[model samples]
Target: MNDAIHSSKAPEPVGLYPHARRVGNLLFLSGVGPRQRGSRDIPGVTLNAQGEIVDYDIATQCRSVFDNVRNILEECGSSWERLVDVTVFLTNMKADFKTYNAIYADYFRDNQPARTTVEVLSLPTPIAIELKCIATID
Candidate 1:
């Protein structure tokens, strides 16, 4: 059976969904963005009052997204080292991949979870990066 999980320490989801779900020994996380909890502010992103992203810094967005993912992982009694797989979304592959990869390496340096990075037209939020992952709780 699977059960949903939420974290007070992480950014609330933009849609109707929990931050993570547990089934057996694995926890699956929803797409975690760079938005801050309560404030809903997206780091590394400069948005117009209309909520359109005018500019962004990939490294900053990547770090914030990772922190959100970490919060969900820790809440599930897991950690970075426990991550088994991850799917990353980026708005600008040509411009952002280099910085994003370098910052990502700093987080999963030793753990080395299987990862796939894809260029998406856009994310649900104005942020430039997001990550959804699965980790073994065992």
Candidate 2:
């Protein structure tokens, strides 16, 4: 049976969807961003009055997004080491890829999951990075 998963410790999803869903032994996580839990602030991001991104630190955002993904996994009876696949979205690939890649290597040094990084025009929020993950769950 499949079950929807929610995490009080993770940031609330910006849309109408659960944080993750478990089917059998696999957990599917929705797109996770760098926003803080219970707050609209995106780490390392500065938004002007127009709600447009003024400046952002890719290193900070990468770490935050990884932590956010880890929180969702652990909250749903999974873990970072259990992750089997990861899909990364970046709004600025040329500008941020190097920094993001370095931080990602630091986080996934022990458990290197299959990853696909893509450049997107934007995201649902004013954040630069997002992650979608899949993990094995007991």
Q: lDDT of all the models against the reference?
A: 0.89, 0.93
Question: What does candidate 1's lDDT look like per residue over 5-122, in tens digits?
Answer: 9899998788999999999999999999988999857888888889898888888888888988988899889998899999999888999999998998899889999999999998
Q: Tens digits of per-residue lDDT for model 2 on 14-124?
A: 889999999999999999999989898889999999999999998999988899899999888899999999999999999999999989999999999999999999999
Candidate 2, residue 44: how far the Cα is off, in Å: 0.5
Candidate 1 regions off by >4 Å? none
Clashes per candidate (backbone, < 3 Å): 0, 0
Give all TM-scores, in the order shown: 0.97, 0.98
> What local lDDT score does residue 77 receive in model 1, on the 0 to 100 scale?
92
Per-candidate RMSD vs. true structure? 0.9, 0.6
lDDT at 116, model 1: 96
Q: In terms of TM-score, which candidate is strongest?
A: 2
